[model samples]
Target: MKELIVLTFAVPLLMAFLLPTISRVSFTLSKLIAPLVLLALAIMVVCIWNFHTETFVLHIGNFIGPQGIVFYVDRLALLFAFAIFAMTLLMWPWYFEKDESSDTRTRKLSLTLLLVAASAGMSLSGDIFNLYVFYELLAVASYGLIAAGNKKPAGNSYAAAFRYLMISALGSVFALLGIALIYFQTGTLNLAHLSEMKELLNNPAGLIAFVFILLGFGVKAELFPVNSWVPEAYMASSKRVAGLLAGLVSKLAVLVIIKALVLIYPQDEARQLLLFLGIAGVIVGEFSAMKAQDMTRMLSWSSIAQLGLVFIAFSIPGKAGMLAGLAVALHHLISKPAMFLIAERWGGSLQNLKGRAQSSPIMAALLILFALSMVGIPPLPGFWVKFLLLSGLSAQQAWLAIAVVLIMTVVETNYLYRVISSLYSRDEQQSVTSRHRTADTFSALILAGVLIFVSVQVQTVGQALDEIAQDAVDVKSYIDLSLGGGS
Candidate 1:
């Protein structure tokens, strides 16, 4: 089982290398391989779930020595890995169908696989250095995918990708410097060992290291201050790539931030800093999103806000907050991708959705479902996450935090309602009643099915998230499970 954890990261990476060669044989064959890869991953995730008793770790080649890297699989990693697999499955077909250019299509597919591999690597990585490596891998692959379309848009893609790369490089430098400082202080890069030696990091050097790493990971996670690159990048990338970026890549980055907080930082001041930044993110992201008109742009801004909420929940310093963060994280992971897909099909503006529900009711319904989920409507998993967050905030006497959340919620509701209202309105002025209802219906139905499934099974899903959050908070359990020699 431990060895299988390594395979989860390795397989997609291996496939990404081989995909171009396989594409030369037949494009259809290459496309066929993607879902199979996702299926295999999904199967492994299920197997992990069925057999899960505690956290586990695998060093490549079973190399438990100081020289080799380790891949740790806890419920937290598994949960995110499962999300990557499921969203990839949902995304692949649409991406391929829309992308008819063979070269671009092939590159897109390869990048997608690479993105998955990197995300898996980040999730499973037990060391700060390994996390940085995976983060770079994800970033480079995203650059390629964003630029894999028509030359006009590709130029925008290049500019966005370049800016992203530059900012990311700066972040990486900071992270590397931090990692170096930590190693100097503790003589090891293993997160578990670092946690054990937390007392050694009580100095200014360690605090500086923490700040650098937090900024590095926070930028990628779309946290405030450093998140200026996100909307433009999403707006510039092809819709499918946008979906991947929004739904998978950014979430993985945020997950890494959470992991670092849980495993590497045990200081109360650090936790307080995280809380302060998170509250600021919620306010900034929501207010910014409220001003956006383009659907894709709106979603991008909304993602920033949603990430802020996730960070806020995680920063609350308790089991309840961690659990709430996990729930919200998972909910957004599912719904945001679906919303991006809908945006792709329905043009990029809310105005264009006028009479969309009348034309393609199914697509409109799915859009509404995802939008409502984002707004935390009843019986949806998103609602429960908010419920948990509000409950946790009230308990902490954080009235300011509560007020910020309320303001963001109202802003979110207004914008999401605009989309919904446009969809059902009788005004046909902005709509083009097309004969391509089949395509629209098919796309919408798939997303709708997923939204409904997640909604109905919220408790079962929430329990899984709770387990993951518990594993996340249990640092001792993580160390014991990862390095316990399988006895």
Candidate 2:
């Protein structure tokens, strides 16, 4: 059963390389292959999670130790794996415009598969070296997807992708340097081994290295200062692609930082840096979003703010931090993508959205639901997400954080209200023209259903999250399972 986990990483990678060639022979088969493979992987993850609730490890080529490739399988890893497949499948470019060529579609599908493979590898890899490798692979795949996203002849997609590449490349350099520092100090890239030598890393150089990796990964996580790529990239990409990046990819990046924090740098200095950055991100993102002129930019800035909250939640040391962060992360995962889907047709200036709700009441209603939840309305999961974060902050005596969060909530509520009002309002002369696509609407509805379901089953979901949090912060178990062969 444990061995099967390798298939999650291996199969997608193998298929990604072979898919473009396969599409040449039979495009229909190519389309079917990706989804079918993802479905199988998702089911396999569920079966594994249901049957074996214990942590495990996989050593590539049966090799062991720091020099060998290792994959640690814990509940936290599996949750990310499941999310990767599920979200990719959801955001798969299933619909095509009249001008979209089969070759274009094939390329997009192939890149998406590569992204999945790389993300799966990142989630499971037990070593920093492999994590860096997979991170770069994911970056390459994203550049392709984003570049190909816009179908318009004069669209700025290529420019956006180029900007993203520059930032990402710079981030990779810092991350590589940080990894070099770690090896220079401790002589091991394996997380398990590094965790055992945390004392050696309890110095300024170590904290600097941590900062490097955080910034490197933070580029994708929409971490402030390194996150200028967020708005342009999202604007240039298709709504689904934008949704995938904001809702899923960012969280995966955060997972990497969380692993490093839990294992190598459990000191107050590192945590404080994270806290300060998180606070800055929340303030900047929320305020910037309020000033955004269009829906896509607003959502982009909003994603940054939401991730800021996740970072803050995780900054609190312990299972409480993990749980609160998980709550916020999972909530954003559900709502943000759905909102982007709704914005597919309603993407331009907010002024143009007047009376949009009159034409598509269902879409309008879905937006209202998502907006209310984002603003932390009662009974919705977003409220509970904030409640968890606030509670954790109060426990930590983080009064400043509490104030920022509360103020940001009010800011978030006000902007979302503006959106909701515009969505429902009717102008005397200027009627909005574009209509929501059926496919996008359906996708949004599916996500809305998930949000509603989670809200209704909040108790059960919270318990499950608590258990996952418990597993996530178990540093010793992570080491034992990875280094001791998960015995």
lDDT string for model 1 (297-360, tens) is 8888898888888888887776887888877777777777777767775656667667777766
Measured against the true structure, the TM-scores of the candidates, in listed sequence, are 0.93, 0.98
In order, candidate lDDTs are 0.77, 0.91
lDDT of 1 at 164: 78
Q: Score candidate 2 by TM-score against the native.
A: 0.98
Tens-place lDDT digits, model 2, residues 83-187: 999888888888776797889888888889989999999999989989999999989999998998774657589999999999999999998999999999999
Candidate 1 has an lDDT of 0.77
TM-score of decoy 1: 0.93
Give the candidate number with the greatest TM-score: 2
Candidate 1: residue pairs that collide:
none
